[model samples]
Target: MRLKVLTCLVAVAALYAPQASAGSKIRVETRTYDVTGASGIELIQNINRKGPKRGFMAHAIALTAYSASWDLVMLRRNGSCRVRQANGTMDLVFTFPRVVSPMSPALKRRWSRFMAGTHAHEATHGRLARDMMRAAERSAVGLETTDDPSCSKARREAGRRIEAVSAQYEAKQKAFDVTEHRGGGHVEHLVLALIKP
Candidate 1:
């Protein structure tokens, strides 16, 4: 069985522009891990200790991940094989930090701002992921080729298109991050404000 898989590892990432097909479904899930911090500095440290790990050494304040898998059916006609249909599903997971400790009024205000900004940032990633899945479905449905009768090449081409969409989306995500995380950028301002004592 040829299963088309697109996976992403990001600090909440990617996007594409394509109309969604009827055969595709996307499932979204959200989870939070609680951290103990009564102050902004403490909260940052708590997040560092409890937040989602992006790589081997750093933890992200929030993160989103997506994976797409699809089953493609191909039909052999006269002298060629073509994709009959592609039924696909995209699964997304979002992880964020939750503070469990009691906070003073000032701390609560700061935390509220931090959480709001973080949610806004992560939401962009979620939107992009959904778009990427739709684009992949568009690339796979009704794909046809005459070069290979066994339909392997057509399947490979579909996979290629799917990966290309993913790569494009990934680049978009990176560009978005660069803008948000640059010095004096939105994320930097948010982080500095949150951590200000």
Candidate 2:
């Protein structure tokens, strides 16, 4: 009976081994950036309101945009960005302060500016991450063959694309700095911003 069980195990392993070998190994890392302040909640809320088309929101707009385009998973709040490596994952956390009242229209305008800038900044990181994963995936496949000029060329092209996209995103995000109060204030307005990727 023991021999039969062992044989069955071996058979199962053999049957699944090829498929497992063909599948690429995936690892994920996340990084969080905190944008804390008295207007942090309002900032996040405004950013979320921009949606995907605006190209300035963090959740679905930035995360989904990159993930869908680059074949990477934009994990929500501690979600993982899967890579074809075993080096675990990176987590990025962004913290911000609470909102207070006495917010004037002028303050709201400033908040809007802040949100737009923050979204642009975070989107750059997202783009970089996506590019990195794509490069890794290509490397995994490229290492297997020798004298495959086509594959090598493709990999090189992919690298260039990644670099270009990363630079563009980074430049856009870094262009604006947060110019507002950091903390301290009473809760005049409470906007519940959903915690998502």
Candidate 3:
């Protein structure tokens, strides 16, 4: 029920600490949304309607959006250019429905379990995003180009390396989704619990 949106942002022009001494750093940003309804079932239905759509499925109990960007600083010395700093950042926005107030003990218990399961799944996706960002940063680090006229060649190579890393991680994310969301998987179990309770 919790789905994640991934965005790969363009290079940003910002001064970051030198990578030679400081190494790479990753920044994570997060946001949350709340939806409310009269009861738990209503809450679920409302959230499903309001959540983001993926492919043909328009209903989701929760959703997470992850946007990542990187800044690469190049240093030129002695007719050679090298990546001096690689800084990566990611933003994770999680949207979920609020548990209805004044619920019966049984309903409250089920709601609690549902929230826990959904959050856990979304957190895993967030972790994967962060990991991919870090990998991209590492790939961008230390890239060099000896082309004399301009560093465009080096820049292009660095971009390709970073993109390759990102693509590989993206494939991993898809594979994980397929495994985790297969029939009778973790997500299905969570949904069944919420509805059958």
Candidate 4:
């Protein structure tokens, strides 16, 4: 799962030029915390206890954190100010569990498979975060004020749009989690398989 990081980080940041390609894609940073166990049950226990605690209360099997930074440019002429460009970058950090104990080859294989699926799920969140940033940039670029020469109005408008975009994307992320977390769904299946005796 991904952190519901504040998308409207600052409402708006002032800048000028065409949209830049700074944070369009994710350069994921993956970190693993060692989980100790020799069997599936023990390994599962360690994971449950040692996994990142970024969720509501219980620990998350894996977690992805996201943040967006924007580079905005404004063009003003004839007492009209408009966004000339907006380049928003998304940064993703992922936390996962690693097995550090000796286990049977069969168990090792199972652990690998489980981790693979878990990583894929977290990656989906990362992609969603990137999409959200792109949407935010689009909203910023579409902002303009025909009379606000000082660009105050334009800045305010951009801020509002950024908030809206962030809210919209947060909803999307929650919906995705709902689908994956439903009974007998993808997430449940992966978890059950990993903890199976």
Off by over 4 Å in 4: 8-27
Listed in order, each prediction's TM-score against the native is: 0.85, 0.33, 0.80, 0.88
Task: Give the per-residue Cα lDDT of candidate 2 at 190.
Answer: 21
In model 3, the Cα lDDT at residue 151 comes to: 53
The per-residue C-alpha lDDT of model 1 at residue 97 equals 88
Cα RMSDs of all predictions? 7.7, 17.5, 3.5, 2.6
**Model 2 alpha-carbon drift over 4 Å, by segment:** 1-16, 20-98, 145-197
Per-residue lDDT for 1-197 in model 1, tens only?
01113553111001222333447678888989998877798989988887887778878888887777776666666557666666677887888888888988988898899989998988888788777777877887778789566677777887788778888887777777788878999888888888787
Note the residue pairs that clash in candidate 4.
15-73, 16-73, 23-89
- Model 2 agreement with the true structure over 65-148: per-residue lDDT tens digits: 222122221111122111222111222222222234455565566656544544554544545444544444444332222343
Clashes of 4: 3
lDDT of 4 by residue, 107-192 (tens): 88888888888989998888788788778878887677898778778877887787788889889888988898889888778877
Candidate 1: deviation at residue 128, Å? 1.0
How many collisions between residues are there in candidate 1? 0
Global CA lDDT computed for model 3:
0.66
lDDT of 1 at 188: 80
Output the number of the TM-score-best candidate.
4
